[model samples]
Target chain A: MWRKLLTRNEFYVALVVVGLCLVIGAVNPVFFTVGNLFDLVRNSVVMGIFSLGVLIVIISGGIDISFAAVAAFAMFVTAKILVPFHFQGTILVPFALSALIGTLLGLINAVLISQFRLPTMIVTLGTMSAFRGFMLAFIGAMEITNLPPAMIAFSRSFLVTIKQGRFTYGLHVSILILIVLAVLVWFILNKTMLGRGIYALGGDRSAAERAGFNIRRIQLFIYCFVGFLAGIGGIVHSALVRTARPFDLVGTEMSVIAAVVLGGARITGGKGSVVGTMLGVVLVVIMNTSLILLGVSSFWQRAVLGLLIIIGTGIPAYQATRRRRAA
Target chain B: MKQIAWRAILPKDTNVRWLLVITVLVFVSMSLLRPTMFFTLDNFSSMAFQFPEFGLLAMAIMLTLLSGGIDLSIVGVANLSGILAALVLTRLLPAEASALQVVLYSLLALATSLVTGLTCGLINGLLIAVVGITPILATLGTMELFTGIAIVITKGAAVFGFPELITFMGNGSLWIFPVPFLIFVVAAAVFAIILNKTAFGAKLQLLGTNPVAARFSGLNNTKLLLQTYMLSGFLAALSGIVVLARTNSAKADYGSSYTLQAVLIAVLGGVNPAGGFGRVGGLVLAILTLQFLSSGFSMLRFSNFFKEFIWGAVLLVVMVINYLTNTRRERREALLQAKECEVNAQAD
Candidate 1:
């Protein structure tokens, strides 16, 4: 049992997380403070949700980069819809609207991929640009600073608060949403027939079909679920940041995709876990936030992130090739 | 004999013919719609100067797609190459230098761009071909890496102050043709010949078509991939040089949108994303078609955002059409094979 745990990718990721935390704490003892912990968890919320959705798509033998555009479009449109009505209600309506919009966008991808049999990457690539362009051209390009009162209040709402030296840090309510979604996604991935079907599909598509799985329905469900999650993530981001910029979430695809991949999700598909993905998200978020504390310049931080990705992807690939050669 | 020569020069693919027709249609329509704005020599010359940077990048990306991979890092390479060349020009060349020094320094800067591009490509090649990472993911990593390096070097600032000779390469005209367009023509001609007439190109197509078969048949798959990526890098560097000359500056984020546009162009040129097939003639025609559409849209006063929308819509539409045509071809071939099999059975 111990050996099995040691061999699991999650275990390695968890170990690295702990080691990194310790290193940072040793350098700046402020890292161990609850204030910083809340900050870390808060920062991880948006990225964590995105990674979970991406993990599902990747596990089912497809990649959906259009999620960023979906998120941006969903939140931006939701904001646009709410601002006109002056509807300052609970956040539920906003979340629902954003998720619905995202679902519609995702349905487009699903039909193109599963029905028309287009390549997932190319289809998503086309849609990413199309959706982004559509929003900027036809809709609106300006950032919405005057978010609904509910969203602004939600941004300020915290589950736990820490006060220190004219600074107050709190674990935002959005982290609770992330935790709940993480649990839900975990249950779906681990305890459902749909989960098994997804695995089979990713492992071998023809075999999955032969084993009585509805590949089309599974794909449809997978992308819709991704879009739904992206919608949630988008709204959460806006709630936290207090604005809806059209270009807010598109470029972050690299980091989020990198995080998922680092979590031991094979780019070729069929393997990953919610726990591992969360750890990967934590690692990425920590690197993004803590490099400043490590005294690395912001410009050099991107180079470091790039190097980390190459090394992270490179080592495993190298080992696999070596193993094949030996065989 | 003349027919043979013509066939050799023009690709025999139906897609290439379609592309040619579309190019002509776009050209003719633009000319008819806004004869004063679109059909003028001045407009043509300006467009000729503007498109080569994009065209060169599209061709670079086409090579990768042809070999069943993608170099998402081409834009990064271009910016980095341009940045490095600009740095060299500013740092090494004196402001008070004579024309002789200017020419010599410009040549050195061009070399710098080419060498930087090659190095970036070598990194991509090593990562994808040797380390065995997927091309998209590998290039995605390098894209960030190269761009990050560029940012760090210039501190996210644009580098400027190139020599007169370098600027001339970008803006100068030679005998009624833009220098950049002339460079593009020469490069495109070379690529067309290489694709049609070289063993390396044939091997690359075979490798992309079926890696296992290529390997079993004694082809060096890694070597071919390395060469392909290196060539991609070289082409990107060429574009970078042109960009530096045209813009008179180099920045980390310049033409970031070109990454996707190049990919779209490559696919629009009828290169199969799944690999094993493409033609330079089709690709060149695709570039022209897009350029004409873009120029026409600008002439008609469309916003840049609208043009982007059109590009994406066009890409998706093209993909759907390609899918339909391919399925039809496959169905017809299957029917022919079935008919032959039925005849053979009856005879037997």
Candidate 2:
């Protein structure tokens, strides 16, 4: 029976994760409320954006532990650029600068990994620290708090509302951005030759090379795309909070990677979906919110989350082994 | 004489030799930048004392890599176990216990820490070997799990005020060298013996090099994996104890930085991430180089961010060089094989 369940790619695990979320929500009535639900969605949007970038890297058979650092750097640059040019017509400068810095950082990672043929894990590990250091040196020990009211208003503006005061919850602009990006990613992954090329390279690089895929170009593009997404996320995050702090997103890579893996992407690379990844982000957000509602200790929340990840990933592992044995 | 000269010109392994030369150059440059401050005996002692904790972690990482796996939970395990030890020695043990009783208590703490590490390792091995999760994902999950447990246990506080004997290992030195430093040296020697001179070591290398081949040859890959992770856990726990003793406190977040540092050392020491090849001596040299650089940076009063940056940069450079050299050698061999085939075809 277990072997039968294991044969399908990630079907059982997905069902289990959804089932667990429902069970937790049932235990706490507040978890199912509109306000809490919207909060969960908001949380997912924040992590999902970053996880989407991580998903691209993992699908390409490379890992980037430096995404958080890139985001932090983006935040710093955006804040610095925006604060000085607070003149009536200059918000675009910070936006462009942040995105550009993120792309450049991503390009550096791409060059080091693809051109040098270096290990992704080690290279990103290095840049993670280097980028963070650059941010610290540039920003000093100060936090940027003078965000433009325009940016804040844009972030908070409701894109859609399901009304009746107590039951009313609205979609923020950030969620719309997340959805748009997710759709774009889905299209690229499924429609374009470059998208197919990424999967091919990840599945088996030599085979992909033999089939005429430009491996270096694909890798470079993926890293840059990841960096771009992280940059956008950074800008959105700072705008939402209305402040940019240097140490704001420390140790955030773990959650983003966790979300991507939970979405059924292999850490070893070549398999993942944007829809599944979005679901993963939602699952984590739901779990955290529900746990809080259930009055569980905040610290125990971390352990529980960790256990969920282990069990979530462990089921697929067990199924794979069982299949290998049967074969 | 001619063979020696040729060997000097073409070192047995260019990457390893290059790393050695680079390490020496870094040390020299650091010494030159702040000659008096960097070379002082007091600074040397302080640096030497702090080296053992990270050094042991590096060794633990090397062992795991040799077994063809990586353990991301080492940092979490070390922190958890160190905190446990501090709690036991300071709060749990009877105040008026005799010397033998105190020794027994310490032994118990050590055993408990080791067992904690073993259990975590068991979970990792079972997930990877039996359950079939990849090492990266399995360890990543456990890294969160273990660290979370530490936080839950301590509520993010540090455990302080251990007995004198326990603190002595961290603070007290034998003549000029710290006791923790001695412990590191002893641990390194023992690990070297286990890795290089034992039958178990041979099997580990075989398993790392080619799992399918090793299994077909009748090696118990599963059991070997379990043992390797368990050993890694034990060493990490030990390092935690040393760190706790040295600092006179055990924080739930201690050794948070060692996770990447250990991997950095393992790779720099010439351990192949793909597994199957590495040397203990290289790891030792890598640890020394890192420690030397870190101490130098601290002496120069570099900010925490810059220190971390330099550490990461050095790791990147070392790994890049290692990867390039290995790939270049493989390409050369492939070319040679192709040439030989072409010549044989001509003759045919």
Q: lDDT for each of the candidates?
A: 0.89, 0.82
- TM-score values for chain B across all models: 0.95, 0.91
Model 2 local distance difference test score:
0.82
lDDT tens readout by residue for model 2, B1-348:
898997786436666677788778878988899899877888888888888998888888888887788888888889888877777787779988999989988888777787887888788888888888888888888888988999999998888887778889899999998899899989999998998899999999999999999999999898999888888888988898898888999887776778888888888878887777788878887888888888888878887777777777787777777677779899999999999999999999
**Residue-wise lDDT of candidate 2 within A1-327, one digit each (tens)?**
888766544565477667866876777877767677677777777688899889888998889999888988887787776678673444455566777888999998999988988878878988887788767854664888877666766666777878866567776768888888898898999999999998998899999999999999999999988888888888877877778877887687887898888888888889998877877777777667677676787878778878878988998778788999999
The residue-by-residue lDDT of candidate 1 on B124-213, one tens digit each, is 999998999989889988998999999999999989877768888899999999999999999999998888799998998888888899
- TM-score between candidate 2 and the true structure: 0.93
Worst 10 residues of 1 chain B by lDDT: B9-18
TM-score of each: 0.96, 0.93
For model 2, what is the alpha-carbon lDDT of residue B29?
A: 88
After the best TM-score superposition of candidate 2, give how far the Cα of residue B196 lies from its true spot, in angstroms: 1.3
For TM-score, the strongest prediction is 1
